[model samples]
Target: MKAVSELLKKHDGTLWHVTPAMTVFEAVEQLARLEVGALLVMDGDRLAGVFSERDYTRKITLLGRNSRETLVSEIMTANVITVNATTRTRECMSLMSARKIRHLPVVEGERVLGMISIRDIMDDIISDHEHTIASLESYIQS
Candidate 1:
């Protein structure tokens, strides 16, 4: 039942982003440098879309597009899915599963807060389970 804000608290609130006009090669470099799977494509403070490894593979590599020439806007997923700080972790998991997406931007009325990945939610769930198991064991020993 932890809120998205609670989860984000554990992470460095860094919203990694790239402009839509950025070349795919540059974006890929940023992705590799940041060690992240996706980057929020931003136009100033607005959320433009998302450019991910999936986009690169499907739109660039498979199509033999030149990464150095192609722009992120051309291959980025335009219709982005976002959540707010108050959204629960379970809801996020369900939404990601239903939408078949790996990354979600946390927004507050148009202001981008941070990004959350499927891996983040899974790690939180595993941690919660471990805590619950420990609590139950402690109770049983009492």
Candidate 2:
């Protein structure tokens, strides 16, 4: 099983974040520009919460709240589920499945390291399966 650290090593370590005070409109714009579903809501260096498309849909649109008037903190997921560098890929998949969440911020103690999506874990698993299948075919031919 691959560790979160190993998976993170395969990608650029860029954590896009927005302050809690930022308007939902701004956050949504950033999400669109970045082509990401979520952004870490940051209070200074702290991980405050996660502002996602789901939050916008459920809390703002469904509730008839104006994005320009609402703050990210108002609709963000306050209780964040985080993983560590040592967490296994399978473990991450399980957590995401149970929580019905797509993104997880990787943390080391109180400091944030990076973020991973369910897509990342699934891709790794698929790649590993392909590698194993190729190895088996090679061995059979030899």
Candidate 3:
């Protein structure tokens, strides 16, 4: 299995994020502008939390809170599940599946690298399978 580092290399290297003090409305706008499902909540250089569409839907919409007034820090998922560059893509997939999470931040020590989505894991798995199938077919032809 390819390491998460490989996937990171393939990415555009954009660490989409927002400040914890930002309003949910502002954060949501950033999410839409970046075309991402989640945004890493940064408290200066520290990784504070993660704000996602699910957070907005469950905490704001269901609770009848005002997104314009509510802070991202108030509703963001603070206990973030992260992976290091050395972690395998398969492991990331398993973690996401078990946690019912769609996004995972890649970190090293306390420094955040980037984020990966379930889509990234799926693409890696699919690509690996296709490569394996082609190799098998080539072997048979030989």
The Cα local distance difference test for each model comes to 0.94, 0.93, 0.93
Tens-digit lDDT string for candidate 2 (85-131)? 99999999999999999999999999988788888999999998999
List candidate 2 stretches off by more than 4 Å.
Answer: none
Candidate 3 lDDT at 56 equals 95
The residue-level lDDT of candidate 1 at 107 comes to 93
Q: What C-alpha lDDT does candidate 2 achieve relative to the native structure?
A: 0.93
Candidates in order, TM-scores: namely: 0.97, 0.97, 0.97
Model 3 stretches with alpha carbons more than 4 Å out: none
- Which numbered prediction scores highest in lDDT against the true structure? 1
The per-prediction tally of clashing pairs is 0, 0, 0
TM-score of 2: 0.97
Model 1 C-alpha lDDT per residue in residues 71-114, reported as the tens digit of each score: 99999999999999999999999999999999999999989988
lDDT of 2 at 14: 81
